[model samples]
Target: MPWWSWILIWVALVALSLLLYVFLGIRLFRQFMATLKDLGAAGKKMGHISPLEQAQTRPEAGRPLPGSAVFASPTVMRHDYEASKSSRREQRRLKRVQRKTDRGQPQALGDLDFT
Candidate 1:
Protein backbone atom coordinates (compact mmCIF):
# COMPACT_ATOMS: atom_id res chain seq x y z
CA MET A 1 0.00 0.00 0.00
CA PRO A 2 1.15 3.58 -0.61
CA TRP A 3 2.20 5.62 2.47
CA TRP A 4 -0.55 8.16 1.71
CA SER A 5 -3.12 5.32 1.72
CA TRP A 6 -1.88 4.31 5.19
CA ILE A 7 -2.35 7.95 6.37
CA LEU A 8 -5.85 7.95 4.88
CA ILE A 9 -6.66 4.69 6.65
CA TRP A 10 -5.37 6.10 9.93
CA VAL A 11 -7.48 9.25 9.50
CA ALA A 12 -10.61 7.15 8.78
CA LEU A 13 -10.02 5.03 11.88
CA VAL A 14 -9.61 8.12 14.08
CA ALA A 15 -12.70 9.75 12.67
CA LEU A 16 -14.82 6.62 13.27
CA SER A 17 -13.59 6.35 16.87
CA LEU A 18 -14.40 10.01 17.52
CA LEU A 19 -17.86 9.55 16.08
CA LEU A 20 -18.46 6.49 18.22
CA TYR A 21 -17.40 8.37 21.39
CA VAL A 22 -19.65 11.33 20.55
CA PHE A 23 -22.63 9.01 20.05
CA LEU A 24 -21.99 7.19 23.33
CA GLY A 25 -21.47 10.45 25.23
CA ILE A 26 -24.73 11.88 23.97
CA ARG A 27 -26.59 8.74 25.03
CA LEU A 28 -24.96 8.87 28.47
CA PHE A 29 -25.87 12.53 28.89
CA ARG A 30 -29.47 11.90 27.95
CA GLN A 31 -29.75 9.03 30.41
CA PHE A 32 -28.20 11.10 33.19
CA MET A 33 -30.65 13.94 32.58
CA ALA A 34 -33.59 11.52 32.60
CA THR A 35 -32.41 10.03 35.89
CA LEU A 36 -32.11 13.48 37.45
CA LYS A 37 -35.61 14.44 36.36
CA ASP A 38 -37.05 11.26 37.83
CA LEU A 39 -35.17 11.82 41.05
CA GLY A 40 -36.49 15.35 41.35
CA ALA A 41 -40.06 14.19 40.82
CA ALA A 42 -39.66 11.48 43.41
CA GLY A 43 -38.20 13.92 45.89
CA LYS A 44 -41.09 16.27 45.38
CA LYS A 45 -43.62 13.50 45.90
CA MET A 46 -41.93 12.15 49.00
CA GLY A 47 -41.02 15.47 50.55
CA HIS A 48 -44.54 16.29 51.70
CA ILE A 49 -45.19 12.94 53.34
CA SER A 50 -44.56 12.79 57.08
CA PRO A 51 -42.57 9.95 58.60
CA LEU A 52 -45.62 8.66 60.48
CA GLU A 53 -47.60 8.50 57.25
CA GLN A 54 -44.79 6.59 55.60
CA ALA A 55 -44.90 4.10 58.47
CA GLN A 56 -48.65 3.61 58.18
CA THR A 57 -48.63 3.29 54.39
CA ARG A 58 -45.70 0.89 54.20
CA PRO A 59 -47.00 -1.56 56.84
CA GLU A 60 -50.43 -1.79 55.17
CA ALA A 61 -48.78 -2.73 51.86
CA GLY A 62 -46.60 -5.38 53.59
CA ARG A 63 -43.45 -3.33 52.92
CA PRO A 64 -41.10 -2.35 55.72
CA LEU A 65 -40.91 1.36 56.42
CA PRO A 66 -37.21 1.63 57.18
CA GLY A 67 -37.32 5.41 57.00
CA SER A 68 -39.71 5.60 59.95
CA ALA A 69 -37.69 3.14 61.94
CA VAL A 70 -34.68 5.40 61.63
CA PHE A 71 -36.55 8.28 63.30
CA ALA A 72 -38.11 6.14 66.07
CA SER A 73 -36.46 4.70 69.11
CA PRO A 74 -35.82 0.96 69.19
CA THR A 75 -37.78 0.73 72.44
CA VAL A 76 -40.82 2.35 70.87
CA MET A 77 -40.66 0.03 67.89
CA ARG A 78 -40.41 -3.03 70.15
CA HIS A 79 -43.32 -1.84 72.28
CA ASP A 80 -45.49 -1.34 69.24
CA TYR A 81 -44.59 -4.77 67.95
CA GLU A 82 -45.41 -6.40 71.29
CA ALA A 83 -48.65 -4.48 71.66
CA SER A 84 -49.93 -5.53 68.24
CA LYS A 85 -48.89 -9.14 68.90
CA SER A 86 -50.72 -9.28 72.24
CA SER A 87 -53.85 -7.69 70.80
CA ARG A 88 -53.90 -10.19 67.95
CA ARG A 89 -53.51 -13.04 70.43
CA GLU A 90 -56.38 -11.71 72.52
CA GLN A 91 -58.59 -11.35 69.45
CA ARG A 92 -57.86 -14.91 68.34
CA ARG A 93 -58.61 -16.21 71.81
CA LEU A 94 -61.95 -14.39 71.89
CA LYS A 95 -62.89 -15.77 68.50
CA ARG A 96 -61.98 -19.29 69.58
CA VAL A 97 -64.10 -18.98 72.72
CA GLN A 98 -67.02 -17.66 70.71
CA ARG A 99 -66.77 -20.53 68.22
CA LYS A 100 -66.59 -23.12 71.01
CA THR A 101 -69.63 -21.64 72.74
CA ASP A 102 -71.58 -21.59 69.50
CA ARG A 103 -70.77 -25.28 68.93
CA GLY A 104 -71.89 -26.17 72.48
CA GLN A 105 -68.33 -27.21 73.41
CA PRO A 106 -66.97 -26.46 76.86
CA GLN A 107 -64.51 -23.57 76.78
CA ALA A 108 -61.27 -23.58 78.68
CA LEU A 109 -61.40 -21.71 81.97
CA GLY A 110 -58.37 -19.65 80.98
CA ASP A 111 -60.15 -18.39 77.89
CA LEU A 112 -63.31 -17.44 79.81
CA ASP A 113 -63.19 -13.68 80.45
CA PHE A 114 -65.23 -12.98 83.55
CA THR A 115 -64.10 -9.36 83.54
Candidate 2:
Protein backbone atom coordinates (compact mmCIF):
# COMPACT_ATOMS: atom_id res chain seq x y z
CA MET A 1 0.00 0.00 0.00
CA PRO A 2 2.76 2.52 1.08
CA TRP A 3 6.07 3.31 -0.66
CA TRP A 4 8.14 1.82 2.24
CA SER A 5 6.07 -1.38 2.15
CA TRP A 6 6.62 -1.76 -1.62
CA ILE A 7 10.39 -1.26 -1.19
CA LEU A 8 10.45 -3.85 1.62
CA ILE A 9 8.59 -6.38 -0.55
CA TRP A 10 11.01 -5.81 -3.47
CA VAL A 11 14.01 -6.29 -1.17
CA ALA A 12 12.50 -9.51 0.24
CA LEU A 13 11.90 -10.87 -3.27
CA VAL A 14 15.49 -10.01 -4.33
CA ALA A 15 16.94 -11.73 -1.24
CA LEU A 16 14.82 -14.82 -1.75
CA SER A 17 15.86 -14.98 -5.44
CA LEU A 18 19.53 -14.69 -4.52
CA LEU A 19 19.18 -17.46 -1.91
CA LEU A 20 17.46 -19.71 -4.49
CA TYR A 21 20.22 -19.05 -7.03
CA VAL A 22 22.93 -19.91 -4.48
CA PHE A 23 21.16 -23.16 -3.50
CA LEU A 24 20.74 -24.22 -7.17
CA GLY A 25 24.36 -23.35 -7.95
CA ILE A 26 25.66 -25.43 -5.01
CA ARG A 27 23.48 -28.39 -6.01
CA LEU A 28 24.62 -28.18 -9.67
CA PHE A 29 28.29 -27.95 -8.58
CA ARG A 30 27.92 -31.07 -6.43
CA GLN A 31 26.31 -32.93 -9.33
CA PHE A 32 29.09 -31.84 -11.67
CA MET A 33 31.74 -33.06 -9.18
CA ALA A 34 29.97 -36.43 -8.92
CA THR A 35 29.88 -36.67 -12.73
CA LEU A 36 33.63 -35.89 -12.91
CA LYS A 37 34.34 -38.62 -10.34
CA ASP A 38 32.29 -41.10 -12.35
CA LEU A 39 34.17 -40.10 -15.51
CA GLY A 40 37.51 -40.57 -13.72
CA ALA A 41 36.44 -44.03 -12.57
CA ALA A 42 35.43 -44.93 -16.12
CA GLY A 43 38.77 -43.62 -17.41
CA LYS A 44 40.65 -45.72 -14.84
CA LYS A 45 38.75 -48.82 -15.90
CA MET A 46 39.53 -48.09 -19.57
CA GLY A 47 43.22 -47.54 -18.76
CA HIS A 48 43.57 -51.17 -17.67
CA ILE A 49 43.86 -52.23 -21.36
CA SER A 50 47.49 -51.53 -22.35
CA PRO A 51 48.70 -50.61 -25.85
CA LEU A 52 50.19 -54.11 -26.32
CA GLU A 53 46.86 -55.68 -25.36
CA GLN A 54 45.09 -53.46 -27.88
CA ALA A 55 47.61 -54.37 -30.61
CA GLN A 56 47.19 -58.08 -29.82
CA THR A 57 43.39 -57.96 -29.82
CA ARG A 58 41.62 -58.71 -33.12
CA PRO A 59 39.44 -55.80 -34.19
CA GLU A 60 37.30 -57.95 -36.54
CA ALA A 61 36.07 -61.56 -36.31
CA GLY A 62 37.95 -62.77 -39.42
CA ARG A 63 40.37 -59.99 -40.42
CA PRO A 64 44.01 -59.77 -39.31
CA LEU A 65 45.35 -56.90 -37.17
CA PRO A 66 46.36 -53.80 -39.10
CA GLY A 67 49.99 -52.53 -39.47
CA SER A 68 51.42 -55.94 -38.56
CA ALA A 69 53.98 -56.01 -41.41
CA VAL A 70 56.49 -58.77 -40.65
CA PHE A 71 59.09 -57.64 -43.18
CA ALA A 72 59.65 -54.08 -44.46
CA SER A 73 62.21 -54.04 -47.27
CA PRO A 74 64.39 -51.08 -48.26
CA THR A 75 62.91 -50.99 -51.79
CA VAL A 76 59.40 -50.71 -50.43
CA MET A 77 60.44 -47.86 -48.11
CA ARG A 78 62.27 -46.09 -50.95
CA HIS A 79 59.17 -46.37 -53.21
CA ASP A 80 56.94 -45.00 -50.52
CA TYR A 81 59.37 -42.13 -49.93
CA GLU A 82 59.49 -41.28 -53.65
CA ALA A 83 55.68 -41.36 -53.93
CA SER A 84 55.26 -39.06 -50.94
CA LYS A 85 57.93 -36.64 -52.27
CA SER A 86 56.22 -36.47 -55.71
CA SER A 87 52.84 -35.85 -54.06
CA ARG A 88 54.31 -33.01 -51.97
CA ARG A 89 55.95 -31.47 -55.05
CA GLU A 90 52.64 -31.66 -56.93
CA GLN A 91 50.84 -30.00 -54.03
CA ARG A 92 53.37 -27.16 -53.94
CA ARG A 93 52.99 -26.63 -57.73
CA LEU A 94 49.19 -26.59 -57.42
CA LYS A 95 49.35 -24.07 -54.55
CA ARG A 96 51.67 -21.83 -56.59
CA VAL A 97 49.30 -22.02 -59.57
CA GLN A 98 46.33 -21.20 -57.37
CA ARG A 99 48.12 -18.19 -55.88
CA LYS A 100 49.03 -16.87 -59.35
CA THR A 101 45.42 -17.32 -60.57
CA ASP A 102 44.09 -15.60 -57.45
CA ARG A 103 46.36 -12.61 -58.20
CA GLY A 104 45.09 -12.48 -61.86
CA GLN A 105 48.42 -13.62 -63.32
CA PRO A 106 48.54 -15.38 -66.75
CA GLN A 107 49.90 -18.92 -66.98
CA ALA A 108 50.61 -18.97 -70.78
CA LEU A 109 51.79 -16.68 -73.61
CA GLY A 110 48.21 -16.39 -75.00
CA ASP A 111 47.09 -14.86 -71.67
CA LEU A 112 49.78 -12.08 -71.90
CA ASP A 113 48.79 -8.50 -72.76
CA PHE A 114 50.92 -6.35 -75.09
CA THR A 115 48.88 -3.10 -74.78
Of the candidates shown, which would achieve the greatest lDDT relative to the real structure?
A: 1
Residue pair clashes in candidate 1: none
What residue pairs are clashing in model 2? none
| TM-score of every candidate relative to the true structure | 0.56, 0.48
Q: What is the lDDT of candidate 2?
A: 0.79
lDDT of 2 at 12: 100
Give stretches of model 1 more than 4 Å off. Answer: 50-86, 98-115
Residue 40, candidate 1: Cα error in Å is: 0.8
Give the lDDT of residue 17 in candidate 2: 100
**What lDDT tens digits, residue by residue, belong to model 1 across residues 1-115?**
8889999999999999999999999999999999999999999998998877665663556434667777989998898789889999999999999999899999999999999
**Number of backbone-clashing residue pairs for each candidate, in the order shown:** 0, 0
Question: In candidate 1, residue 80 scores what lDDT?
Answer: 79
lDDT of each: 0.89, 0.79
Question: What is the per-residue lDDT of model 2 for residues 16-71, given as tens digits with 9 covering 90 to 100?
Answer: 99999999999999999999999999999999988999877768863334663336
Q: How far is each candidate from the true structure, as Cα RMSD in Å?
A: 7.6, 13.0
